[model samples]
Target: MTSLVVVGSGIAGLTTALRAASLGAEVTVVAKAALEDTATAWAQGGIAAVTFPDDSVEDHVRDTLAASAGLGDAAAAGIVAAGGAEVIAELISHGVVFDTDSSGRFVRGLEAAHSYPRVIHAGGDATGLEIQRALSAAARAHDGIVVREHEMAADVVLDGGRARGIRLLRGGVLHADAVVLATGGAGALFAHTTNPSVATGDGLAMALRAGAAVADLEFVQFHPTVLHAPGAFLVSEAVRGEGALLVDETGHRFVLDVHPDGELAPRDVVARAIADAMAEGRQVFLDATSLRGGTAENAAFLASRFPTIDRAVRAAGIDWSAQRVPVTPAAHYLMGGVVTDLDGRTSIPGLFAAGETARTGLHGANRLASNSLLEGAVFGSRVGAAATSAPRSRGRVGPDAAGPGPLPRQAPPRADLPFSRRALQRLLWDHAGLRRDAIGLTRAAATVASWRASRPAQVADAAAAEDDNLLLVAEHLLAAAHARRGSVGAHVRSDDPFTSGKTAPLPEATLIGAPC
Candidate 1:
């Protein structure tokens, strides 16, 4: 049997495994934690697609590219946008339940940057959890799939040009026909993020180690309003979609100063606005009190749209029916990763990537809200089917000579001297947070280069996350940010704001490359 290994167990990994198994391929799911504990299961907004009859593929595609800034790859964006409903239908066929009205048509939701109300939802805002339930149930009984929970993929075992297997913690050297790494993003590299602790950009880091190219590493998106209470709870954009307003400390509406879309402007702009307000000594709030532009009844409308947000508000000693919920910016999404083609094949032959860790060019500078889940599901299946056909000779690669391997590791430090994972994350958040100056970027790049310069000596270490991995991933991101001398999309450089003006055309495009 040609064994195909899927190294992530989220929506992307699960869908890929299911599709590949159905194609009569042997599949194994390797996860760092429980299968359901991923960035996908925690998503709040529903998938965006042209579900309703009035919505056209052109409309959805245009809106998506418009939101992508000028950096969108037009063909990739069009393919994903047009394929949206087909994937949603496929999800339904797998027993994933999306919300529907009495007429039985899928109930839709609206978010910013879209021209139509085409997002298919589930039990209000629990869309991610509901879809996960369906995918997980399918994987459990998939006779051809072997699930290795808590089995973390430490590195891709690359011999020459193609992938043969991976080095994992639970199972040492597991040979495979091909590999797919959909292990989410590097959001955990920040002090505050909505992503699970496991989301430390493992897939990106692993791929880079194997000489794969990554793109747009600097464009990290921050959610405009995550609850500022302990642990930094997420206040979904669905709350704003349901008519909440962004107000200041004195309860004054403040979003209009940024964009006409008001509370619904793209995430990066909104996040910076909220952060600036907080820095000015004025508290930020999402006032669900009076609704967008309606009456008293509009105030309570948010409760019906997003029960999770309402519940969180209640838990935090506030009521959406009568008060403003406190919120702040939190690191949310990364718009860059291992570069891949439309079929999900990365720069490395026999290796593929999907989800947030793969820059498929569908989400250019900024991702449209809720489009991520839809993208993951669609491309992951494509990766799986193609991967199933790869030659599984295992070649000259030897077999495992051991039992269950070492435990999966967290992010590692560099060779000679070191800092903890938390320390590395703190350092990124401090100097590389929202604003950027030459001094700050130089310091970050110099530190990462120093780390990268130490990798050749530590190749003999058995630890999963050697200092080499951290330096490579960190320096890749900083190098991209350094080359992108202008502020566009999620890359906000405070010192170089006016670089991309009309008089001077912004040739400011950065593609896949390794750090020097």
Candidate 2:
């Protein structure tokens, strides 16, 4: 029987494991933390799909391409859009319940860049948690799957350009026929991020070290309205889709001046607008008070439909029904990762990547709102089947032709290092955050290079491994951002002139850490 090792416990990882197990492969899920501790569990918006009669796969694909700003792969986007409904149906069959109207039809809602109300949720704003719960339960119940929690994948064990297993930081190797990387994104690289603390780009760094090609590492989507409070909670774009507005301190809709679509413009546009407003010393707010409409019924509906946001807002001492909530863009998603084909095959053999860790070109320069979840499901499902059925043959050489074999590691210093993860976080935020320039990128790259040089030749623990991964990932991101030199999509360069076009000229994918 073929054995597969899947890293991560997010929606993508879980789905891939379950699918692979169902196909008669013995699958083991190794996660750095418990299944619940993932960026997917923190997601507020629901999954996007063509569930309604009014919605068409063509429309979904078109909107995705438009949001991508000419950087999206049309073929990949179409696959995701067309296969979304089937994946949604599969989730439902696995006991995942979605929100429904009084008449018992699946309740669909709209989000930015979506032409139709096709985003389906469960427990209102608690959609991600719901999906996680369902997948986790299904995986746990399956007999073919084994769950390994609290274990970090220290490195990818490769043999002559082919992936064979993973090296665990705690010690031990799990040899497998295939390895699926679903380790989520590196949003936490930024100081202000909606991602959980665990999202430190470990998977991407592992792939890079093992000689896989990563593309578009610079196009990180910053959510336009993360609540600017103590906890920095995320304010879902569904709020705006439900008729809320983005207003400045003077109660003027500033997004209109930026784009005709206003609050519904692509996330990059809105985030840049919000950042511009904040840079000018103006505070941005999400005003949902009009949704109350002076009616108790409407107010109750608003509270019930977004119970999570309502509770968070109320706890923050601001009632959305009575006032506006302060918000700012926060690092949310990575649009590029380990370069992969539609089947999740990366540049290396015996290795595949799915979910946020893989760049399948579904999301180009900017991701359409709520498409993250769908991409995970669609590609996760595809890669599982493909990974299991493929023959075990010699794979193509990665950029580094040297085989990925176990190498001697140097242990991190026992004493406290001058640079800490918190300091790294602040460095990335200041230099590689929402707005970046040549000067900041250069300094950031130099600083990270120095840190990398200081890193212990060996990783002994999760902290040390993560620190090393952060430095490597930061270097790649900074390099990519520096190479782009133009403001397009999520990568906004204040130093460059803005193009007055609907899309950026097709961007060449910025590759890092690969041999010339």
Candidate 3:
């Protein structure tokens, strides 16, 4: 029997392990923390899929491409869109109970950049939690899979130019015929992020160190509505879909001036708008006060429709129904990583990646809202099957065929800066966050390079290892952002004069929401 090592225990990792196990492969899942402590569990927005009769795979693919700024691979988007419903059904089989209305139809919600109300949730805003619970339970029940928690994957063990296994930071190695990387995104690279603490770009760093080609590291997606309070709690895009509005302190709906879609514009547009407002000394707020006509019924509806968000908002001493909630944009997802084909084969043989860790080109420049969950489920299954079936001696596949060739890495100028994880986060947030320009990116590159020069020769523990990985990934991200001179998708170069015009309008069908 083939042995597989799947790193990270989020939806992607767990799904890969379960699928590979079912295919008669002995699988072991390595998680940096407990299974529940993943970014998947923190996801409030539901999965996107074509479940309703009004929705079609073609429409879904079109919306995905549009959001990607025409840089996404249409074939990859079509594949994921076509596979969405089936993967959603598989989630149901794994015990993920999605929310339904009184008539037992799925309670579909709309989000920005989606042409239909196709996002399905469970436990209101607790969709990710429910899916994580179900997948964790399913993986535990399967005898063919083994779970190893607190085993941070520090590096990919490569032999003869192929992936052989993983090196655990805590000690020891887990050898396998195929190694699948599903280790979430690099949100923690920024100071404010919705990702769990373990999202230090571990998988990407491991791949880079192993000499794998990565792409699109510049297109980091900043979620537009993280609660500006202490914990950076994410306010789901569904709230806006349900008629919430984003407003400035002066009670102006500024996003409408930026784009006709108003709050429903692509995430990068909305996030940059919010960042611009914040830059101008104006605070932004998500005004759900008019949602559902702001009646007593509205409060109950919000509580019922978004129980998790309601609780968090109330805990922050804010009654969202009565007042606007303070909000800011924060790093939420990475659209690019170790480049992989549709089957999850990276440039290196025996090294596969899925979910947020892999740049599958399904999400071009910007990911359509709520597509992250679907991408994880669909591609995780594909990677699992491919890992089990692909020949061990297959040759390297090179960079992703759908996207442009990998950005050239330029050597950085010499600079000196103090280095700590906190300092690194602040550096990225200030220089590489939301809106960036050439000067800021160059400065960031220099700082990252200086830190890399001074990094410890050996990682002594998990924290140190994570810091090292963050530095390495930050270096690459800065380089990519610096190289890409034009503004596109989530990567906004403020100094790029070519894209300084008014925001482009989205399709008419996707702009079908209003604030009450």
TM-score of each: 0.89, 0.93, 0.92
Candidate that beats the other on lDDT, 1 or 2, i.e. the better one:
2
Give per-residue CA lDDT, model 2, range 1-516, as digits (tens). 778889999988988998899999989999999977899998887999998887899999999999998889999999999998898899998888999989989888889988888999999899999889899999999999999999898888776667877878877777777889999999878878999989999899889888788888989999999989977799999989899999999999999998999999999999989988999999999999888568566568778899999899889998788788999898999998999999999998889999999999988889999999999999999889988875553443233432253222223223233578878888888888888887887777667766776777767778888888888888788878887767778888888858421322222332234521
Predicted candidate 3 versus true structure: per-residue lDDT over 223-254, tens digit per residue: 99999999999999999999899999899999
User: What TM-score would candidate 1 get against the native?
Assistant: 0.89
lDDT of 1 by residue, 1-516 (tens): 667888888889998899899999899988888988888888888888877889998988788788777777888878888888889988998899988889998888778787888888886888888888889888988899998887767778775677877887544777788889989888877788888877877788888777787888777888888888877778878768767789998877777788889888888778888988888899998887776445456545666777777677788888767777789888898889999998889888888898888899888878888888988898888888888888876464655321122222223233343545666666677667776665676566565544444445424442335344555577667767766777777777888886351122122231223441
Colliding pairs, model 3: none
The true-versus-predicted C-alpha distance at residue 357 of model 2, in Å, is 0.2
RMSD of each: 4.9, 4.5, 7.7
* Deviation from native of the Cα of residue 39 in model 3, angstroms: 0.6
Ranking by lDDT: 3, 2, 1
Positional deviation of 177 in candidate 1, in angstroms? 0.7
Model 1 spans > 4 angstroms off: 292-303, 394-396, 399-418, 448-471, 499-513
